[model samples]
Target: MNGRLRELSREESLRRLASVGVGRIVFTHQALPAIRPVHHLVEDDGEVVIRSHDRTALLSALDTVVAYEADSVSGDDRIGWSVIVTGVARRADGADRYRHLADPWADGEPGYVIRIRPELVAGFGLPEDNGHAP
Candidate 1:
C-alpha cells in the first residue's frame, strides 16, 4: 500500500502498447460514451490500427476523436501499467502501407482499416517497490 505510482514516457508507453494485442476503443455513440473491445496492432510510428466489419459502429467513426487504451497487470501482486491514447480516428485506404498490419481476432474478410494517430499519449504504473525502481 506504500508503493508510488510513476508516469511513463511517451516512448515507454508506446512500447508497452505495442506489446499488447487487445485493447478498448472509446468513442461517442448516441451522445454517450461507448467502449468496444478490439484486437489492435501498434505500428512503430505510434499509430494504432484495427480492422472492423463494415457493419460495425466503429467503422463509422472515421475522422472523429476517440480514445484507445491498453494495459498489462499481474494478478497475484496487483501491479500493472496502463496506457491511454487520445487521437483522431481515420479510415486508412486499402493502399495505405499500414492497412495490412491490422490483425483481426475474428475469422472473416476485414472491412475497414482504422488508424488512430495519437495526439496525447499517457501511461502510468504501480511498480513493485523493493526500495528501488521496478
Candidate 2:
C-alpha cells in the first residue's frame, strides 16, 4: 500500500471517532491489559458512550481511566483511519435514552450506560496514495 500517515488534530480526531460505528474499550484487568469490542456512539459534546452488562469486566473500570479506539479501513485500497480516546469512565445515570446508543454484544438488555469523557484524543489517517494529505 502506498500512502502516508496523516496526523489528525484533536477536533478532527473526535470527528473521526464520531463517524465510526464501533470501537474497542481498553482497560486493565488482573494487572494486565484487556480489550473488549463495543458498539459506540460519539455524543454531540464529544463524549463517547458504550453499553455494558453488570457482570462484564468493564463495569469494574467505571470512574477509572480507560482508552477507547475505533478505526475504519477501505477494503480495496487499505486506506484507513483510526482514533483513540483516553478518558475517565463513569456510569450515565438514568441512561434510558443513552442506553440504545451503544449496543451490547452480550445477551440480555444492557445493564448500564458507560460514558467516557475524552481527556486525550489522538488520530491518524492513511490516505491511499493520494497526493493530498488527509
Candidate 3:
C-alpha cells in the first residue's frame, strides 16, 4: 500500500467550508473565552457572514482579530477532518445591503450581521493522537 498522506490545499479548504454550512465562532470577552455555533453563508470573495441577535455578546467584543473554527466529521471509527479559519471580524454598518444578502434560519430575530474576513484558512485530519485506535 502507498503511504502517501494528503494535506488540504487552499482550494480544498474553501470547498470544505462551503460544504459545511455551520461552524463555531470563537472570540474573547474580558479575558474569557467564548464560542458560539452559527450558521453562515460563504461569499465568492471568501468571507463568512453570520447573523446575530441584538443581544449578541460576540458583536460587542470585536476590536481585534478573532479565530473561527468550522468543521465537519464523519466515520464510524471517528476519523475526520477539521477546518479552521482565523480572521478579523467587524460589524456591518450597511443594513440594507447586508439585509438583502443575509438570512437567518429562523425569522424574527431582529439581528445584526457580523462579517469575518479570513486572513488564514487551515485544515487537518484527525490521527490517533487523542486516544483513538489506529
lDDT of each: 0.76, 0.78, 0.66
Pairs that collide, model 2: none
Q: Tell me the deviation in Å of residue 74 in model 1.
A: 2.7
Higher-scoring candidate on TM-score, 2 or 3: 2
Ranking by TM-score: 2, 1, 3
Q: Which 10-residue window in model 2 sums to the lowest lDDT?
A: 125-134
In order of appearance, the predictions have TM-scores of 0.81, 0.83, 0.74
**What is the lDDT, from 0 to 100, of the residue 134 in candidate 3?**
29
> lDDT tens string, model 1, 13-61?
8888888778888898777788877778887799988776634678547
Which one wins on TM-score? 2
Tens-place lDDT digits, model 2, residues 21-123: 7889998877888888878888889999888764468777788899999877566655477789999999887557765564556554646788999999988
Q: In model 3, which runs have C-alpha deviations exceeding 4 angstroms?
A: 1-6, 54-56, 75-79, 94-106, 126-134
- State the TM-score for model 3: 0.74
Candidate that beats the other on lDDT, 1 or 3, i.e. the better one = 1
Q: Distance from true position, residue 15, model 3, in Å?
A: 1.1
Q: Against the true structure, whose lDDT is highest?
A: 2
TM-score of model 2 (CA atoms): 0.83
